[model samples]
Target: MFRFIWLSDQRWGQLEPHLPKNQLGARRVNDRRMISGIIYMLRTRCRWCDCPAG
Candidate 1:
């Protein structure tokens, strides 16, 4: 199957600065991956629970 990556490094670099820091809890290590999954689901019109696990 062809893999889809919605966020490129350059795009993520631009976006990363605007995202809020996680100060109150443990830092999330997979924010980019999680956002990519979300974008893939939205673009593909798949159900949230049906999104593939990367």
Candidate 2:
């Protein structure tokens, strides 16, 4: 089974400033959640659609 680990507040604080803002379209999902999902998929070698929802 895959274990999901979320980003800590401190890490999110450090990373938040570097993420780009979406100015033209609808607001994007939470960066931390998106990044966590990506990392989980990469680590588990799973398809994007197979990744677990938050």
Candidate 3:
């Protein structure tokens, strides 16, 4: 089974569809990713270059 918790950024979905997309060509891929990353970093105490940032 899978468990899920709403991300902080997802709470801003109401404004997503209204924003422009980045160079990645995503009009709204959900800011949840950025928020989630930041949150995970806080919990892991890992440097950005240690993983994704690397």
Task: List pairs with backbone clashes in candidate 1.
Answer: none
Name the candidate that leads on lDDT.
2
- Positional deviation of 54 in candidate 1, in angstroms? 9.4
Q: Once model 2 is optimally superposed onto the true structure by TM-score, how far is the C-alpha of residue 18 displaced, in angstroms?
A: 0.4
Q: For candidate 3, write residues 1-54 as lDDT tens digits.
A: 223334645556665676566667535554666656667677767687775431
lDDT of 2 by residue, 4-40 (tens): 9788899889989999986778778878988977777
Question: On a 0 to 1 TM-score scale, where does candidate 1 land against the true structure?
Answer: 0.72
Candidate 1 vs candidate 3: the TM-score winner is 1
The digit string of per-residue lDDT tens for model 1 on 1-54 reads: 747867988999998898778578876767787788778877778787775564
Q: What's model 2's lDDT at 20?
A: 90
RMSD of each: 2.3, 2.5, 5.6
Give me the displacement of residue 30 in model 2, in angstroms: 1.3
Global lDDT of each model? 0.79, 0.80, 0.58
Arranged by TM-score, best first: 1, 2, 3
Q: TM-score for every candidate vs. truth?
A: 0.72, 0.69, 0.42
How many residue pairs in model 1 have overlapping backbones?
0
